[model samples]
Target: MILADIPIPDLELEAHDGIDVPHDLVALSEPLEPGQMLLLRTLDGVHRCAEVVGLDFTENETIYRLTYGAPMAPEIAAAVARPPRSALRHWVDDIDVEVLLGELADAARRTATTSQAAAPESSW
Candidate 1:
């Protein structure tokens, strides 16, 4: 099994659908396999978990493709990044986590179907 311990300054989901970490850039040993687990740890203690959907091997590096939900909703990210706060009628409460999550999953599924029909994205 491939093992990786990634540490990042920040976890950026937007601007790039999936991240490309040079095999030398992180504590990555061995090539990753499809369906393997990927754990991303951000500087602010915000951790995102994902499963490896694809793997590209370069001369000396491996690129992991791990998301269909390219850019997560800013609101969801913001809420998860904050420290727990018990406030009345807070913005966090206003967010319907379930609905937002359902929509996100559906959108991701659609995107995946469409993308699969097109040429595969280059993994640099």
Candidate 2:
């Protein structure tokens, strides 16, 4: 899948860079489905990928629980590896849902290819 093939929503996020590690506070217009991958851009211009595990609303604010993963850009991998904390309450307003979806499709393709290569050939 590509960026043009997916439907994306407009979201507004509050910037939170109080500490050395920068993250965003995202308020989703709609509830995110489970296992949805998101592409977040940090305040310092780093692109990171995360999978949405759960969502909760508190005090009229939607909180998304994400499991942080590898950096999209190789240059910032080292920086993203070391973070000040691992809390998952922050949100970012600007994200390319299309790009995130594309990445997910690509990953799935790679996994399928690897599995096919490893499987033994059938005589049928």
For TM-score, the strongest prediction is: 1
- Model 2 per-residue lDDT at 24: 20
In model 1, what are the clashing residue pairs, if there are any? none
Clashes of 2: 5
lDDT of 1 by residue, 1-124 (tens): 1223456554455355557665566556565667876555445444455567877887866877764243334334444444445546556444566755776677668667876889678799
TM-scores of the models, in the order given: 0.41, 0.38
Residue-wise C-alpha lDDT for candidate 2, range 31-74, written one tens digit per residue: 55557765555544445555667666666555666554443553
Candidate 2: global Cα-lDDT?
0.46
Whole-model lDDT per candidate: 0.56, 0.46
Candidate 2, superposed: residue stretches over 4 Å from native: 1-24, 74-124
| Window of ten residues with lowest summed lDDT in model 2 | 1-10
Q: What is the lDDT of residue 111 in candidate 1?
A: 64
Model 1: per-residue Cα lDDT at residue 103: 62
Report backbone clashes per prediction.
Answer: 0, 5
lDDT of 1 at 89: 54
